[model samples]
Target: MERWKINLIVLWLGQFMVMSGMTMIIPFLPLYIQEMGIHDPHEVAVWAGLIFAANFVSSFIFQPIWGGLADRFGRKVMLLRSGFGMAFVMMFMGMAATPLHLLLLRLANGVISGFMPAAVALVSANTPRERMGFAMGTLQSGSVAGTILGPLFGGVLAEWVGFRPIFYITGGLLFAASVLAAFLVKEKFDIEQAKTRPKMSVFSGFRELIRIRQLPALYSVTFLIQFSILSSMPLIPLFVQELHGSGQLLAFYAGLVGSVTGFSNMIASPLLGRLGDRLGSQRILAIALIGTGLAFIPQAFVTNIWQLLASRFLLGVFMGGLLPSVQTLIRQYTPSGMESRAYSFNTSALALGNMLGPVIGGAVSGLIGIRGIFMTAAVLLLLNALWVRLSLFPRNQVQKTGS
Candidate 1:
């Protein structure tokens, strides 16, 4: 097997473990706060929100710094740094005696979190350009699959072994992933070339990359893709309640509604990526954006949980095309020696989207209600599609077909 293929397989598993470990706390975060002697429901809610947001906030700020280092040092080293750093932090989180300690630990975890972006950089740098779409799509599938199953596994383990022990288990998973990467993942990095590369500060590197044609637009698309999809997530349970009524099965139905989209997304990501490789990633991105926008409309008006689930599933299928295409575009446009920095900037956009999505969603729901949030997201995505068409597709440039 080729070296790139080996890195892809190992990094795919590493990405899965990293994402899974990070999300495993989602199901019991609030419960953990409550256990920390927080009796008031409102206090628990506030602490949970703060603790959750802490990671994204730190990650958004530090991603570029790490990206610069990855460009100078090596992507595999950065990956190991994040994987092991997160492992130790997660284990210590199990030992946290107070909410403050947990909050600080989450912040530290965010600072050390670069495993996914580093994995993408390594794979992108090593893979054949013609197969970039397939590799990216395959890599994305692993991350999405982990995200879809993490909460489920976490919830079950939390019930069986309690909250703190779940943290220890998550830590163990991360450590094992790091060990695999250490032994198995290979990167053909030119150390002398990397050393001789011109040095630039983080912000300057970001500015230099942003000057590349089509990159800023691609970054915006990345942000909008995440913002549009995640903006409605927090309100799903409320929307489900409105459709199904508050019943004993509400939690089960809510989980189903949430997981169904990811299930379809996991299936569609690689298939659509392969299609993009043939049909042109720009074309697939345009169609997926339109499809996703239209899919949100049905969710806004769904009269029952089943209708909502179907709509979300359809949305997921289209969504599978968005990020991989964007990443491929980024790789195509970025100059040699700055791929990691470019990907890191993209990661920053993603972190911003993750951080702001729920806050804005909650605020929007308060103003226009949950249905209005859906409509707003649909409009934003549709407008994003127009932006892509105008900025990315030149009138004279013909779309590239198969490799």
Candidate 2:
């Protein structure tokens, strides 16, 4: 296989490990807190929200810093840093003795948790432009598969060996990704560019991105894509519970509801990627945005597990296309020497969505009901679709940048 292809595969698995490790603790987060001596349900909920948000808070602040480093040093170095750093931090999280300790460790985790986007940057930097959509699509499948399965795996492993062990296992997998990346991933790096690149402060780089007409829109697409999808995440289990009532099998069914979309997403990603390559990424992205917006409405009104599963599966088909198109658009618009920086900033935008999506979703559910959040998510995605139409396809062309 070609070197770029090799890097794509390595980074695909790396992204999977990164996502899987990050998500594996979710199934039992509150339980783990209880183990740490927090018995009050409301206090557990508060701590859980705080600890989860801590990761994104620190990650949002640090992603641009890492991006600049990736451009200056090499994308691989950043990948290894995130991979190994996450491994150590996840292990530390497993060893937390108190909610404060877990919260602090989760904060530390955000500082090191750019591995997935870093891997995306590495593959984006290395892949040929024509194949960018397909490569990203394929790569996304891995992470999506991991995300879909992570909760299921977490539940099973928690039942079998307990929650702390899940963290250790997740940490081991990330460490293994570091080893694989160190040994197998290769970049046709420009040492001269690294040495000669002007010192661009992160603030100036943000300003510079704003100077580019399409970049901010592309960044918004990145943010909205994450925001729309994650807005449904914190409420899925509750929705499932509402559909079927609480039982011994509630967790299992809830996980199944979550995993099914990932199944369709993993299947549709590469196909939509190739479709985007042939049909124009912006056009397909528009289709996906609207399609996903529509998909959420059916999910909002589902009366049974089958109906919800079908709605989510449909949602997954369009969801598969959104990010690859966004990444392709990013590749088209970014300048030659700043691939890592743009992706890193884009990752920051994604982190911001993650930081806020669940909070907003939680608020919607609290005020309305379980199904109401899905309606809110649908409206948000529809608005985002309009933004894409206005911002990206203004003249029916993604004005080719001077790369």
Candidate 3:
């Protein structure tokens, strides 16, 4: 492999490991709350929802701050801070004796969680423009794969070594990633460009981020993409329960489904990104939204756990392309010096979706059932597809860089 390919692989691996570890906390949180003596479903649900949303709430608030800092200071610095910070928080979470403690730790972790965004900034800055889409896609696959595998392993580890051990394992993995990143990752800002880069105030930069004309559509699309994806997540465990799977087997099934989806995402993301580079991010985004909508629509009727898992895997195949394409589009829309704020805005939108998705999922699931949740997500996605088609597709407006 070439030198750049080698760097890409290492970077991608580090990101994957980091994401996998972070996500491990997701699948087992409620169970841990139960073990700590909270038995009321409503209480467990509330605490769990708070803990889950806490990270996003913090991250959403801090994402742009971190992004601008990365631009001014360095991407690697932010990546190291995020990786190490998350590791410490995860370890602290494992040691928590109360829901409140866990919630606090999660909130702090979210405030500092900028590793993936930093990595994207690094890739955007380092990779050639022509290959940037592919690089971003590869990086995104790591995140998707992490989400898939983290839950899978989290469920199994929680069952075997118990929830506390899973936390230790996740924290250890993140720390290890930090160590790797510390040694291997290098920043390469253009010194000449750096010197000439205008010093935009934080408020002005944020104003610019929000005021960018095409960005709202991009941000809206990101929110809907994440919303549609997560709308199905919190209920997957419940769906497994309806399949007559025991709790022990349910954990394994969760991992199995996660692994399958991760595999599909891993396989498809880079190819799709490469395609986006050739065809246009708008084209890829439109196709992905439509495919995801169709895939999600059938999941509501899944007859068994296997069928449900299969639908998830199929959905992953389409959804895997969406993030990188969005990243590429954001880069295309913003000027070179403004990349950090643009990415920060994108990250914030996704974090907002993360924070909102589960609360809505829980409420809607309570009112209409899990099946209805899937249908609701499908309708939302379909609406997004139409909106993109009617509005965003017209200009063929995959803007070129610095436009």
Candidate 4:
């Protein structure tokens, strides 16, 4: 096998472990806060929200800094730094005695969390241009698969071994992933060329990258894709309750509703990516955005859980096409020496979306109700689709940039 192929495979597994480890705590986060002696239900809810957002807040600030370093040092080194740093921090999370300690550790984890972006940068830097779409799509599948399964595994392990021990297991998984990358992943970074390249401060680099024509639009698309999808996620369980009523099976049905989209997303990612490679990433992105926007409409009106599940599954198929196409477009638009920086900025955009999505979702749900939140997301996505068509697909630019 080619070296890039080997790197892709190794990094795919690494991404899977990283995503799985990061998400494993979600199922028990509020419960863990309660264990820390926060007896009031309202206080537990507040702490849980703070602890969860801490990671994304810090990650949004730091991703570009790490991206600059990846351009100067090497993507693989950044990957290892994040993988190892997250491993140790996650383990210590198991030992946290207070909600404050846990919140601080989550912040530290966010600061150290560059594994996914670094993996994408490394694979993007090394893979053949023609194969970029397929590679990115395949890589996305691994992360989605992990996302779909992580909570399930975490929920089960929480029952069997309790919450703190699940943290230790998650830490072990991250460590094992780092060790695997240390031995297996290969990068052909040119040390002397990197050393000779002109240096730019983090802010300067951000400005320089944004000046590129298509990049800012692509970054906006990245933010919107995440924002639109994640905004409805926090309300899904409540919506499920509205459709199904209270029962012993409520949790099971909620989990099913949550994971079904990811299941279809995992299946569709690589297929859509391959199609993007043949046609045009810009074209696929437009169609996917429109499809995703239309998919959200049904969720708003669904009278039962089965209708909601089917709508979510359809939404996932379009969701799979969104990010990989954006990544591919970023690569095509970025200059040779700045690929890592561009990807890092994109990751920051994504982190910003992650941080804001649930907050905005909760606020919107309060004002408009849960079903209306779905309708609002659908409208925003449809507007974004029109934005993509106007900003990214000018006929002359399409001919100039190629598919």
Candidate 5:
């Protein structure tokens, strides 16, 4: 059996558990805040946003630190560290008696959060160069599948067992995942040589990376795409209610829309990744951006749930393509021997998007009606398509490195 294949399968499982633990709390986090004695509805909403954003905010600060460590030591260590660290924090979260305690735990979770990106870096470093797209796409599919199942399972589990128990359950899954990874994943490392090598600080690495012409734009695309997609999430339930009015199944309907995208994304990611492997990630990325833009148009005008579902489904397929393509580009251009650092920096861009997307979505909702968010996202995607075409296509020059 090929080592890369082994890494893929084990990391796939690890990533699935990691993604599930990350998202499983979203549906009930506000409820947990209320359970901790917050009664005012507005206060609950504010605290929910703060707790939710807290992880990403810390992650954005800490990614480069772990990335540098991964480059010097080995990615697997970083992966195990995050997996175990997050597991402990999640279990501790179950004991929180106040919203502040919960918020602090979440912040700690973010500080320890690099399991997925570390997995990506490990897989990217190990895979055959020609297969980076397929590996990343395939790995991404597992995470997407976990994300799809997380909220659905969490909702059901919350109803069946209550919120605090859900935390313990998720923590157990993460711990199991870390233990499995400790046995199943392996990396070839030279600690003595790694120690001898002149190590660049994370900020220095970022500075060197920005000097690459294509990287900043790619990073911007990472930020913009994430911003555009997430900008709509907070509003989805409200939009559903506006369309159908209040009912018993209203939350279910909103969740259906949320889950459907991950389902489609999980299904399409690997297939589209293979397509990019053959057709070139640049070509696939442009098409995905345009397709995503077109997909959003119908969503903005949709008068019914089915229409929204169909549009979101298509958007998911394109989204599945967009992200892997970006990763492929990052892989293509990364400086030799610096793969971990490059992915870490890129992960920061993504973390920033996760933090800011909701804020932008919320602000947009305040100004324009719910439909405007979709249109705004669509426009950003379309413009990005043009930017990609103009930037990468004309020169066909993706600054090459042995990486």
Candidate 6:
């Protein structure tokens, strides 16, 4: 493989391992807090929400800053910094004695958690334009797979040893990613440009968010795509419980469904990316939306765990095409030298989706049960698909030739 390809593969692999470690902690969190003698379910729930949101809050605050730094400094150096910073935080989190300490560490982790963006930047910077979507899709698949494995592994480790041991193991994996990143990656920071360019400003970054013309459409797809894809999250554990499974079995099924989705995404995203390359990202995105919207319909009617898992697997296959296509479309619309800012805007939209998706899904699921959430998400997706098809993809010829 070429050097860039090699580097991307290494970065993707490291991402997978690191995310696997981090994701493993989520499912086992309630159990860990209970083990710590926080017997009050209300307090445990509050802590859980705090723990979940802490990282995102910090991440949302820091991503634009990191992205700007990456633009000036170099994508590789930032990647290494992110890996090392996360490693340190995860190690510290492993050793935390209190929920406050853990929450603090999670916040710290978020501040430094730009590894995915760094990796994406690297791919975007080095890959040829024709292959950008495919490469990004392939890269995304690795991280998604990690989301599947992390929790499952964490659950097993938590059961076998304890929650603390799971953290230790997770930290170790992050440390390994740091080491690999430090050695394998290389970049040439633009010292000349840094010196000549006006002082970097968050204001300028925010300006870029406003300057892009098609951004509203891009962000619209972003919100709907995330809302569609993630609406299943809060209800997964409940779904497992309703099936009358043990906690361990619940963890296993959670892993199974997650693993299936991520695994299928891994298998399918690159193909979609390639398809986008051959056709156009707009076309691929439209088709992906339709497929994803249609896929959710079956999820509402699943009678068994196997059926649910299969539905999710199919959902992943359709959803896999979305991010790569979105990223590519955004890149096409953005001016040169603005990749980082553009990406930060995209990340902001995604974070907004993340913040709202679970709450909305949880609320709907509570009111009408899990089935209702699926139906609502599906309808939203279908509407989103129709909008994109009419407004975006059909104008592809005008877009591609820069009329």
Candidate 1, residues 275-331, lDDT tens digits: the string is 988998999999999999999998888899889989999999999998889888888
Off by over 4 Å in 1: 397-403
Worst 10 residues of 2 by lDDT: 394-403
Better of 4 and 5 by lDDT: 4
Clash numbers, per candidate: 0, 0, 1, 0, 0, 2
Q: Residue 322 error for model 1, in Å?
A: 0.9
Candidate 6's C-alpha runs over 4 A off are 240-255, 304-306, 394-403
What is the clash count of model 4? 0
Rank candidates by TM-score, best first. 1, 4, 5, 2, 6, 3
Report how far residue 190 has shifted in candidate 6, in Å: 3.5
Q: Please, what are the lDDT tens digits per residue for candidate 3 over residues 1-403? A: 6545655776788788877876777778888999889999999999997887788899998988888877877777888898888888888888899999999998898898888778888778777788877988889888887877777788778778988987888788888878887787666866566556777776788787767666777787889877866766777777777774675677778657646766887889999999988988888988988888888877788888778778888988898777888888788778767777788878889988887787788778878887888788888877877666655554544344215
Q: Tell me how candidate 2 scores on lDDT.
A: 0.85
Q: How displaced is residue 295 in candidate 4, in Å?
A: 0.6
Question: Whole-model Cα lDDT per candidate?
Answer: 0.88, 0.85, 0.80, 0.89, 0.86, 0.78
Better of 1 and 2 by TM-score: 1
Q: Give the per-residue lDDT of model 4 (tens digit) for 175-273.
A: 998999999898989978998999989899989987876788888888887787788888888889999999889998998998899999999999999
**Order the candidates by lDDT, highest first — what do you get?**
4, 1, 5, 2, 3, 6
Alpha-carbon shift of residue 170 in model 1 (angstroms): 1.1
CA RMSD of each candidate after superposition = 2.5, 3.3, 4.1, 2.3, 3.3, 3.3
TM-score of 5: 0.94
Candidate 3 local distance difference test against the native:
0.80
Alpha-carbon deviation at 165 in model 5, angstroms: 1.9
Judging by TM-score, tell me the better candidate of 1 and 3. 1
